[model samples]
Target: MIGLEGALYPWRFRLVLALLALMVGAIAWRMLDLQVLDHDFLKAHGDARSVRHIPIPAHRGLITDRNGEPLAVSTPVTTLWANGKELQAAREQWPTLAAALGQDPANFAARLEQNKEREFMYLVRGLTPEKGQSVLDLKVPGVYAIEEFRRFYPAGEVAAHVVGFTDIDDRGREGMELAYEDWLAGVPGKRQVLKDRRGKLIKDVQVAQNAKAGKALALSIDLRLQYLAHRELRNALLEHDAKAGSLVMVDVKTGEVLAMVNHPTYNPNNRRNLTPAAMRNRAMIDVFEPGSTIKPLSMAAALETGRWKPSDIVQVGNGTLQIGRYSIRDVSRTQGQALDLTGILINSSNVGMSKVAFDVGGAQLFEVFTKLGFGRDTGLGFPGERVGNLPNHRQWRQAETATLSYGYGLSVTAVQLAHAYAALGNGGAMTPLSMIRVDSKPGTMQVVSANVAKTLQGMLQEVTESPRGAVRARVPGYHVAGKSGTARKTSVGTKGYQANSYRSLFAGFAPAQDPRIALVVVIDEPGKGAYYGGLISAPVFSRVMAGSLRLMNIAPDNLPLPEQKLAAAGQGGRN
Candidate 1:
């Protein structure tokens, strides 16, 4: 019985050995097939699962002021994403991930379900690097973070309108940002990276394409002047309880915009509950009837006709003129006054300007306005820049002609008005306005004769220097040349003008003897105290101009004789 049992045990052992050998041979054959015969295909399939061509985010360009101070910049950040299907598999870890993301777990779950068919979904965007790292450290399956950039504004709302803002993905959205998007947004790159099953990056394999960062953009805005303009415009709005306001400053010689500000502005940094009204760059977009601000240009047109000199008298009887279908009356009490061109401007006599326009004729007046950069592009290339309405001369009715003479029946933006005034200050040469810095002197067009510009400059000086003119626009010790406009606001949803609402405007240049800067201020619907341009907008002009001239080290033209002599010696006739 023992021998029979031993024989059976050996037979069992042989049977077991044969089975083990067959299993080993099958395993070896399978290994050889995978590693040799199907090596490339299997490796490619594995790499398709583990390796990824990840995008390397390129840093956005820097937006700097003329002085090299950063207005808009990109800061390093991270965006966390998840493979929806993989993340759904790790349902137990959803709560932990949701807590780390500062999201409700149920909402996170719902979001995941909504995007379950999507291979990839953004879990959270624009997180701080440190915080993003902490979430990745949790090692949740399918969770991953990619390097990105977030736009930051250092000047905040002060330069928001001009420098503009970018989106969460660092794309330019408004202002110069939107205008120069291609120049600012750089090309992204790609690289092969090996990732684990949990979607965690293991190592970079190879750079398929190198990333190229965006180029730096330098704007014409002077930070100092911008802040000053912002403060003064904001304060003026508060002081007058005005609905809105806009201010623009330009270099008379270069036509570079030095400062531009608008009220009801928004902080580009935090755009929560942002309104569209708050984001408008009013100086560039909003238009208003320039009122008496157009008188100077009308006077220029009158002068260009060679029929009326600056001293030519126009009969302004009873301070009213009856054009067809319109009875235009002067706001100032210049009753039965026969005033010259200068007197008419000083008094802002609608009757006097109407006579001038009538004498010049509509065709000639429209021609002059066209030459003065009206009803045409300012060549700023800015987004939403409106060329204010100017009617054709052939279409002008008698009332249209009269109203056009005294700055009605037409519209203009603050920048356009400022640009026109800058042409006057720049010896009748029109330089295309620039939002970017001009390293060299820009080319200019001779819109009007230098003699005509000089003559108008002298006349405009009286508008600020004379007691009857915009006296509030006077900056101490500086000769101011500007016009004051108190235009009636057009009624909303109606044809005629509103009785109570008005737009107060002041457009001018400083140091009339040798104008260095031209500025325009517009205060919409002043609800407190005085509403005249001389009273509301002119004072703001005064304050901002005073600071701006001092900052530019411009010599004051109205200094006392001895002080003037001293300044001339110090400046060496530079002014």
Candidate 2:
């Protein structure tokens, strides 16, 4: 019986050993599956347990003026982010962290509790470097600060319209920012870092790719001229008691915008109180019906057609003429029944200009105006520019045609009108208006005959020198040439005009004999008892022109003679 019991015990022990070996083999197989066969899934699970990703921002480009002055720049900043899961787990410490960061403790805890599943979340952006350092020194479990860039506009409102502003993430939002987003937003790169069990950045592994900064943009805006124009426009708005004003100065030769200023401008840095009206770059975006300023183009067409000469006589008919159901009249009635073309321009006769348009005909008039860059986009590359309205010949009624002859029934931007005048000043060559200089050679288009342009220049001079016109636009030492326009603002849903609401415009070029800078000034709804362009807009033009000329070191057209001779000549002439 003992032998039999011993043999049974050996068998039992063998059976137990076999079962334990089977258990060990099963455990090894499962381990191999998880560590090797299903490696991706298990690795992802492990990463979910310990690894975290933080977004890295690429620095935005710098915006500089033509002379390399910084208009917009990017400065180092700190952004606060958090691992929501960890922040929620460390709830007790959140109160202290919130107080140190000057945040509401309740809200901070609530936000972390609400988004605990999210691995990454932003708490604050665009904090100064010092503030970010203070946040970092807190050594909170989940809160972290990273280096970033915040855009800074050094020129403030002066360059606001041109340079534009960026979003919190350094993305371009308007103006040049929106226009050149791809060029301004640089490539983003990644960084591989090791983290400890508590989710702290323990070791920085090899960087995947080094981040590259964005390319800098050098604009064609002249800072000095821009400041000058802004100051003058602000003063003009105040003096005229105007609702708003815009002034644009263009270099005739290169079509570079030397300065563009709009009153009621808003700083892009702080746009909390900005209105759509304040953000409007009226010089490029707003269009008005040009008024008598359109006369020169009509006169140019008539002269080009060989149907009229500067000295040719026409019956002005008591400063009034009727065409179909509409009647056109001059500002003042003169005794002359007939007047030459120069006399018509000098008096700014609506009747004479309408007759000139009639002789030139609708087709020819439209062709000439279109050729002179009216009612078209100047391709200046500014955002929100309008391609001002001009009706086709098929759309024209007799009244429309007649009124358009003297700058009505058609809309044009201030920049377009200034460029048209520049074309006339630059001997009929139409250069592309530019806000940024291009490295490629610029091309020119011939818009009018040089002879015709010279004749138009003389006619514009007559308008400035005329007693009833824009005499105030004249510079003291230069032969100024320009025109005045006062158009009643059309009220919405109304057939007639609004009382005391007018857009007054003064457009011209300076040193009239050989024109240099072409300028346009527009005042919206002047309330200083005078709404006329000659009164509200012309003086602003004069001041800007004088300052620009002096800044550019242009020689004065008139030089003072010896005091004794000048005084003697004046006395003798009086005698």
Candidate 3:
């Protein structure tokens, strides 16, 4: 029995030894796999949990006016973010964090649950630096703040349509902002970062790339003139109870838009309730039949033919001219008169201009208008600028030509009108319009003969300087030259004109001896009482021009009765 027991013990001991050997082998294999064979895989998994590629936000550039006044500036702000998985574990701290973030606790929890699968989530964006830092002060796990930029407009609604606004992500959405996005948007950077198990940032490991700050942009707009235009336009809209209005002032020589303002403009800084209508830059976007404001262009076309002179008499029999199923009539006051070129303009004579347009014919008129920058880009590089319709001359009939002469059967934007008038004031030289400050003078094209442009300028002056003229547009100390246009608005879904709706317009330049600036005012649907361009838009032009001339330091040309007479004599006026 002793021998059997001893043999059984040995067998048991051998079995135990074999089992221990197998366990040691398995442990050795696991160590070899982890330390060598699967080392890269394990390390990669660990890095995936703790190492993150963090984005470094780049600063956006500034937007300044021509005088370096800040129109749009980037203010540093904070964006609160979190790791949803890690944040869910710290549910107890959610209430404190949410309260500091100005979010309801229940909503915060629900948001966390909604984004639980996401490693990164934004809690709030575009908070002020102080407000964002206060939330970070709570020291909540899984919560973080990334520095970002929020665009602020100093001019507010006054320059909103020009400078435009950026989205919450600091992306340009409209105006010069959107037009120059690539020039303004900077490149973001990336860095490797180390984080703890709770997704809290421990350290910035290494910067993979450096952020590139955006470049600064300077616009051609003068803030002072912009404010003046804004005030005058807003006042006119309110006074006339108009639907909307737009004003554009241009330096006739430089082709720089000094001020462009639109009524119903939105506050770029706060666009919570922004509508498309309020955000539209109508001075460049809206198109209308320019009415008698275009008669000067027609007269310019006539004079360019060399067959008609400013002194040539146009026989108007009873103020009406019939052509191809259409009858054009002027106001009864100036009917049945033998009006010359200057007289035609002074009376705003549709019949007389129609006769001149017929003699000049369609092709010559179209050529002149085309050269004057109608139906083309203003070279502003602005977004959504409408090229108003100027139908091909080949498409014109006698009726269409007459209507076009009187500013119908075609459309033009306020910017286009301002540009054309600027060319007229610049002695028939058309330059590229600019929305940015020009370091050098822009190249110009001879759109009309200098003699024709000079003669036309004199006639335009007579429209405002004569006894029977647009006296409301006259600036006190300046000799103003412009035309008044009371255009009937086209029907919405039809071809005819709206009976009562009209677009009041005035396009003119000041200090008529040496034209410095050209301004155009368009008031749409003046509903309160007045609708004539002489009544509604001309006054606005006067007020704005007065302020603008003062701001520009242009000497009043009409000062001193002797100088006025000398200037008028040199300029060749009828009255």
Candidate 4:
């Protein structure tokens, strides 16, 4: 202290200076390396820890019916997310935050503990805006709300099968929603931001990408008709005590589907109890034997060969048909002594149908069936749309061919039947069926000449007007034409058909001349006293088709109740 130079040791002083210089040099070299030599690599590593590339979710599109009623909509919603570490560090704020999120504080703490290693976690995936803001007002560190969309169906189960639905992540799962997913889902966007170690977004670094909202979709479905079909199908199922049911209606002019419904359908909005059984769209996915409904088409095919006439008579003695060892019988059939082509269709005689099918031959019958949209996808682009089984004509045995004529050897979906019958209404030209609204007209394929279609239309008219026709199928103020079918369902776990299990179906078009609408109704395994298609399915078709035709403002072709003494004036009683 008396003399600093005299007291200080030179060697120790030199050593200290050298140590300071070494430290300075080491720091300078590190700065140079970071600033120039390895600058990009270091910066990247730093950014990895402090910067986050966040997803900017693009909003989804809307779906509307042909009348512009919203069937599906994407509503804005907020999702609450959090950083596990930060949320855990602020234990004092846990109760407030958990309460705002409607979660128990103790359970939330346990969840935080379990996911401590994770940097990000979802607290609530979908929340209303009000609820989300309430959670953010708590000011809990590391908690954030991300904007997203929740798909909602306005028509509920009434349009469930046609409109389909989306999952919680806003992705299509079934029906038309899945069929046009690419067209409805828009491109997503992205952005970059700076975050602190605790995972709080400090500032926006840059906009990495821009977002694009999804395109709106317009369907060919008429929501009003859909509701009508849905309600009528449910009522029929309940009245008949049926196991299941399906219905389809199409615009004959454009082949646009107006309504498609299935019994036991689930509510798309409430997805809490979903099952494969309830979700199955029987109209487009399942197939069944069509019974006497095939009579008209068989006649059409025979007439195409120029060998059959509407006036040609067939002897349907005792109303029983025999082919090989298999015998086909009707349900208490009358007017069986002699039936012309029109009378055979009107009465739905199995024996008469067999006779006509034989005249057409197996190859011709197969061609007619294939041309009617059986055994192939209808090209509606719906997921799980079935191509109903139709064995090649080369495999047809005498019994098989006869049974096929009566709708036993082959099967057809409700939509397939609608497609075929709609073609008849559209001058024998089958147009491509569509679920979405089209800007251009759909193409058509001529399956039969217009002359044949006119002749067939007249014959079908007899089905509703003849003294021994399906009286229940007639709409009082309109000239309705359709055929009734009754068939036995195949037994479970067995190849043969069940005696008591029956499927009832009615298919045809209305305003008979200049037909505008065609529909098919199928009820499976009716447990009630009446299981025949005329008794079960025809009444439903009458109500729905009549209501629909009236709603569309179509001019009535038949006389009003007061003027028409038809019901009182010798109208045919149902068989």
How many backbone overlaps does candidate 3 show? 0
Comparing 2 with 4 on TM-score, the higher-scoring candidate is: 4
Q: Which tens-of-lDDT digit does each residue in 354-416 have in candidate 2? A: 877777777777888898888787886677889898877676666777888888888898899
Please give the distance, in angstroms, between residue 514's alpha carbon in candidate 3 and its true position after superposition: 0.9
Instruction: Tell me the lDDT of candidate 3.
Output: 0.90
Write the number of the candidate with greater TM-score, choosing between 2 and 3.
Answer: 3
**Is candidate 1 or 2 superior in lDDT?**
1
lDDT of 4 at 90: 85
Alpha-carbon runs more than 4 Å astray in model 3: 1-50, 196-198, 393-395, 561-575
- TM-score of each model, in listed order: 0.89, 0.88, 0.89, 0.89
Return the candidate ranking by lDDT, descending. Answer: 1, 3, 4, 2
List, residue by residue over 1-575, the lDDT tens digit for candidate 1. Answer: 86787687888768878999999999999899999887987999999999999889998899999999999999999899988887878889988989999999999899999988777899999999999999999998888788999999999999989988888888888999999999999899999999988666799899999989999999999999999999999999998999999999999999999999999999999999789999999998988899999999988888887888887788888898876667989887743468988999999998889988887777777887888888888898999999999888656677878888888888888998999999999999999999999999789999888999999999999988888888999899898899999998998798998988999999999889999899999999999868999899999999999999999999877768988789879899675
lDDT of 4 by residue, 1-575 (tens): 62586357677777888999999999999999999898998989999999898888877788999989999998889999888877777889888877877889899889988887788899998798988998888888778889888998999988888888877788888887888888888778888999888777789989899878888889998999999989999999998789999999999989999999999998988989988898999998888888888877877789999988899999889988776678877655767588888877877777877877777788888898889888999988899989889877555666777788878889888999999999998989999999887668789999977888889998998888877788899998789888999988987798998988999999999989889999999999999778889889999999999999988999998866764666565665542
Clashing pairs for predicted structure model 3, backbone only: none
Cα-based RMSD of the predictions, in order? 8.2, 4.8, 6.1, 6.0
Error of 1 at 255 (Å): 0.7
**Candidate 1: global Cα-lDDT?**
0.90
